[model samples]
Target chain A: MSIEIVNVSKRFGDFVALDSVSVSIPSGQLTALLGPSGGGKSTLLRIIAGLETADSGRIEIEGVDATKLSPQKRNVGFVFQHYAAFKHLSVARNVAFGLEIRKRPKDEIRERVHELLNLVHLSQFADRLPSQLSGGQRQRMALARALAVQPTVLLLDEPFGALDAKVRKELRDWLRRLHDEVHVTTVFVTHDQEEALEVADEIVVINEGRVEQIGSPDELYDSPANDFVMRFLGPVTELGDRLVRPHDLQLLTGGGEPDAVPGRITRITRVGFEIRVVVAVGEQLVTVTLTRNEFLSLGLQVGSEVQVRIAPEVGAVVGQPRLLGAV
Target chain B: MASHPSTRTRRGPVTYLVRLLVIAYLFLLVAWPVYLVGKNTFADGMDNINGILEDPDIVHAITLTVQVAIIAVIINTLFGVGISLLLVRYDFPGKRLLSALLDMPLSVSPIVVGLALVLVYGGRTGWFGPGLESMGFQVIFATPGIVLATVFVALPLVIREVVPVLEEVGEEQEQAARSLGANAWQTFRRITLPSIKWGVVYGVVLSLARSLGEFGAVKVVSGNVLGQTRTATLVVEEKYLNFDKGGAYATAFLLALVAVACIIIVSVIRPKEDR
Candidate 1:
């Protein structure tokens, strides 16, 4: 009912591709393998899909030895980084390919292909070849095809990577809904932190071919296991040679400029609902996101003496503060 | 802030130069031959080339070439795809060696390929010629020998094309096919073939072209039986030897035309990227 990967290590010649990677994905849950490129996330997904075999370790899906199984025998579904749909077949035919291979009654396969295509909201395009579909549609067709067999586990590798920004954002929500409806154990690989946060129930952050951290998205963002996870989870910039997020700082209104505060409002960014206030904390200017009403209320202009609050208790000291100012 | 998509990517001059050089070289070599063949095939009924156009002997040679090329291409396609699937998907002892050996045809000279076949089948005392004769079969200095040479020469082309396409093709569709209760044959027939169909077609057509134009290797094995074992290229050579310049040119022109036409069809029918 679940996938259990244990002590899996893959090596390509001398380089360690996956070092002792181990994790368990419970049935009916969506897990995200979040990492940078070459971080072994795709490697892990491929191993689970039986597209790759590890140098050492074990994989069990629903209490079966999946590591030893051929991809055809694993009963696991996979969606590649590209949709990888068969270009020659119509969408319905591609979806029914699995059923046809299984030698199901032809009528049954016809019924199932229609149902699956409808589920993916691609019923109208079912008769068209895969090449004619857009990127998002192709991905959905791939999903429908994978699901036609009613696989026990489903794996996707960067399913939205090839899409544009709008399509990628749209597919993220659609995919989550699809995963919820299917209620099958699934894992997807992604390098985008926002994608991992939005779609996955459990996010496993990987770095240098090893799992750096694994937890709920909020937990990992709030309390990262180490520096890498903290830096990776959100938009962070070097502040006084220390990592800091815009929301981490508190702005005080009318509190006399804190003694020794670095010189002032050098720039402003109009962000529709919010005006980003830029403060030159030294040679470096840091942008602080704020609402337009808040900026109007401040009524401050260029060279306005301002006091900015830094929660020292939260921001970790990274290096020499004075030296950063000189730069 | 959103950045310029074009400016976001920066390629070094070295990469640019390499790409341009390859494009130019391909246009020069592949494009030139293709243009010449196509131009002559449809050249405005010029009377000057009439002798070359009307030679019935050349028509016979063209027919012979097309027949052999079609048969040879079909055989190669079947065996090539079978072997490519085995190489990319399955694992067994000496798999690495077998994979490397697949390229032997491409690396070994065609002339030498003919010599190898001859040595194996008709060398003063071949390992199989006598056995084949006892079984009322023949492999050398006959039609079978011509076919053997053609197959050996065209073997690598299809496998090379199919393997990469198969490797890039996702395993999921085939896996999905199997889980749906498909047997091995069903998965191969439904999923594997569809996924790599375009690639296989392109490869087969290219192989056919090469088979039609193949000379030295097939010549050595065919024993040059006129109208029987004599292929188009051999026919062209015989016409040229007889000082029938017009007939030789016509045969050569027709063979070239078929090769060019096949390539054009392949390009036109090739699947577009991410279609």
Candidate 2:
């Protein structure tokens, strides 16, 4: 069962929120909707969830038209950005609510609630209210609550936005594992490019309600369609009309310029296991990565002349200009 | 209100004067009435020499007043919360107009409220007069009339309190619940209900307080028969008219004490979120 969003558009009074956006979300794969704020990423998710309707378009799940379907009939689970669990209900009750609403057998609901709670690793805190849970725990509870319904599709809007960095990373991995075991059609939205790269099987980069590009992280990173994809994927080292990985450049051995690009050392700083060295060519400050021993051997202070070279044919090419609306 | 830098900072004379004047105005306008109600009701033996605590009729009148208020409040709680949910959750034609009309009770004079109800069910020439009285309904100049008047005076407070909170909650959580395959009623019971429970509680409390002290409307409609439609306020008026100042004071004191108690209880249970 796949979701087909065809020529979807939305207008709010005077402002057009989405303009002729279309995407197909295949079943059993995790898709990330990446965009900047007001880029209509969340709006598209809401349309899929049927929280908001498109002004003109067709939405279908598994060949069944869902264009006019209410949210309840859409049969899609949504985890909101702000962990919209029932604040008054305990975690167990919150998870059980979906089942209860579906009129599942009481015993079945009890079993499912426990199972979902265990899935999210929140079984211990199942009796506590949502207000009492930390942000991470609340998000897990919301996910568990969404999962309880056995929905065919799961949509999340900025699921990790409220979480701290470490927790965000942990939950991103957790979501990937959950998606694997459940094997459900899942679509999640996030502005964090790293998160989209790490968690999503295919990232659909959206900009102002339109799709910019859609591909796997490695495919996009190794062969970027444009400069936006390259800079967005990882830190870059830009040289003459070309961008290369920082690690591609090596320091020269001799005092004279090696048969390569030559420039004066502008700055150096330690980063994690490696040190980054900046070389100035005219007005440009090109960055290169080096080991501690290599940096020490060079013994170059600020403004010391140095030689650097990058194999342009091997790495990424300078791609298209970034479209203004390509969030 | 201007915020001066600090106690140690330099201050303008105008700023200082404005702050002092506002404080005094609040103290006089709001605090002093509360203070008088508390003081007069709790006066000692020397103050009680005026017989402000010893009249059995006044005591009985206060009891009747409270009974009517409680009935009015309970009925209002049900209607107000129901109507508020309807206004906040549903989208129907004239919904905006219906919502705006909820505040008609608050805007209309209490005496006008009583007259309007009397015109509808007055039993003399009212809209429902013949039909109701033929079925043995003693609505006008009766206990039901008093309750109807109090209810008319108290209906809007609850709606005002509950509506804004419902607006803030929006349709998000309810839509979320329904999307989980919850039936419409189940969605409302589970999602919409809990979200607005605090707001409902606060609205009901305020409704109770206003119902307890409803005088103008109740006076106009309740055919003031002594010891019957004669509520605590009417008893005080009767005593004062007879030149029984001490007895009037006693009756007024009893009524004030009960009203104060209801107010305190409501204030305590008002929604902490204040929305």
Candidate 3:
């Protein structure tokens, strides 16, 4: 289901958790509420799920007002960061909880529970208590439980936030595949820019209780609305007065190009297939990313004098420096 | 590198001394007195126990004590779980004050609690006693009075146990339940209750022990009427004061058995539940 949030505001004592934030989440799309910690992304997701109340706003789900609806009435599935598994209940029973509460037929509840457990790849652990499952398995069980009710919108608050890094990556891909198969309008809150950019069909950047920008991953990365959005989406380094991606800056052995700025290489670190070179340009530090082949050809090392310029094709295509500052 | 020695195998003289002191102190304060009570009760090889079991008044007193204790535990469990949930999950004015006040029963003397109940619910001179008696309900110096006293003395035990568990368990699972289309009642029944089950059980056992052993409050409010208001604890005092030390020792032994059983049950269940 599509979700339209309008003028939502939330306050906890003196702290403003969400400030007049508004965003439209399209139906059947995986959207991420991305932000730094305590930036109100999770709060927004909770408000959408009716787990939290907004001070002043209207939440319209599938074009119907849901601001006053209880979480049970809203029909939005929610997953918590800590897995929130019913510790005493077995995995299958946990998955069947919503159906049981809805008074669904016993046979149907069992069938649905089986189907969901299989979907989450946890059919074997159905009879085990949640504590017996690993972190990833528990989170998957939580996901299966949330999906058991066939909610219109699936809301997850840092669903993989508690998992280890390797498990988090696996779950991210798994979630994307699951979203494709189920096609439920999904909204997940995360502070991880990479996770959002990698998995979400659309991204809403929130900061300091306000919506900073909203767009697809490439649109947000390539055309950020302000300095915060740019700095948050990926790595950016100061070049003279403008902030530019490290890979966008090209390095030359000597000052040849008219627009090239001279700088001294301060550090060179090889990571995977790329070489990250930090340059001291005037008083500002700029990073230039070079391919491994290019770095070997140039024979550059620390303290090597170099000239930095935006790549010619990129500069020509953009027609101006990518100035990502407060706008 | 050499492996470090295990600390368990390295106990020093200080540790031994401390362990000895604790054992000696427990023996002197608890074990010795309890042993004497058991010995005295069996001095005639179960004759005293069998004799009390046959006495109609003593049997009636024991039955009445069990009934009062069961009722008090029920009331306290319901009230305790409800108050604990409110304290842990909701916010309102005077919440801190209410939380602080829940421990009053634990700190206040049982005699004072009974006197307070009498001052409010006593017949003839109590605040609501005359009106309540007119409406066909006698509170002070009656069965209800005894129940009230017992309930008041054991009130905080359940709340004290359940509140910490409730706080530790948090509201996340409850929220998850609600989000899965479970209503408030279903959430409590299926989610909240199960998570706090151990805490409630521990509290119920403790409250049961306390209610069974209640003496000062029951004394003040019960008026200690023979066969009607005299409980197990009251019968112990009555038998001792009347020089029937054998009967008193037998009753005390039974009460002590129950209390020890409660402790053993809790200790047996605690480690498993904690895991």
- In the order shown, the chain A TM-scores of the predictions are 0.87, 0.88, 0.94
Candidate 2 residue-pair clash tally: 0
Q: Give one digit per residue, the lDDT tens place, for model 2 in A1-327.
A: 499999999988777788898888888999999878888889999999888889999999878899999888888999998888887789999899888877789999999999998899998998998888999999999888888888888999999999999999999999999999999899999999899999999888787667777888777767776667677667887766567678777767465543366678878889888999889866677898888887888787778777666643545656322321121
Give the best candidate by TM-score: 3
Q: Order candidates by lDDT, high to low.
A: 3, 2, 1
> Model 2: per-residue lDDT, tens digit, B1-275?
15644645657797799899999999999788766755654465445424643556555567778888889878887888789889977778999898778778889999998888889998879999668999998888888988988888788887887788888888767877877888778887878877888777777667766776677888888888776777877876777899866566656655566656766876786666543
Segments of candidate 2 deviating more than 4 angstroms: A237-262, A290-310, A313-315, A320-327, B1-79, B82-109, B112-152, B163-172, B221-232, B244-254, B264-275
Better of 1 and 2 by DockQ: 2
Docking quality (DockQ) of candidate 2: 0.60
| TM-score for each of the candidates | 0.71, 0.77, 0.95
lDDT by residue for model 1 over A196-312, one digit each (tens)? 999999998988889898898888887677768878888655556656666565455566644225558888778778777788776767766667777788786777767665555
Clashing pairs in 1: A1-A62, A101-B182, A102-B181, A102-B182, A131-B275
The deviation in Å at residue A9 for candidate 1 is 1.2
lDDT of each: 0.80, 0.81, 0.91
lDDT by residue (A178-273, candidate 3, tens digit) is 999999999999999999999999999999999999999989988788888888988887776676778878889966797688889999899999
- Using lDDT, give the best candidate's number: 3
Q: In terms of DockQ, which candidate is strongest? A: 3
Candidate 2: C-alpha lDDT: 0.81
Ranking by DockQ: 3, 2, 1
Give, for candidate 1 chain A, the lowest lDDT window spanning 10 residues.
Answer: A316-325
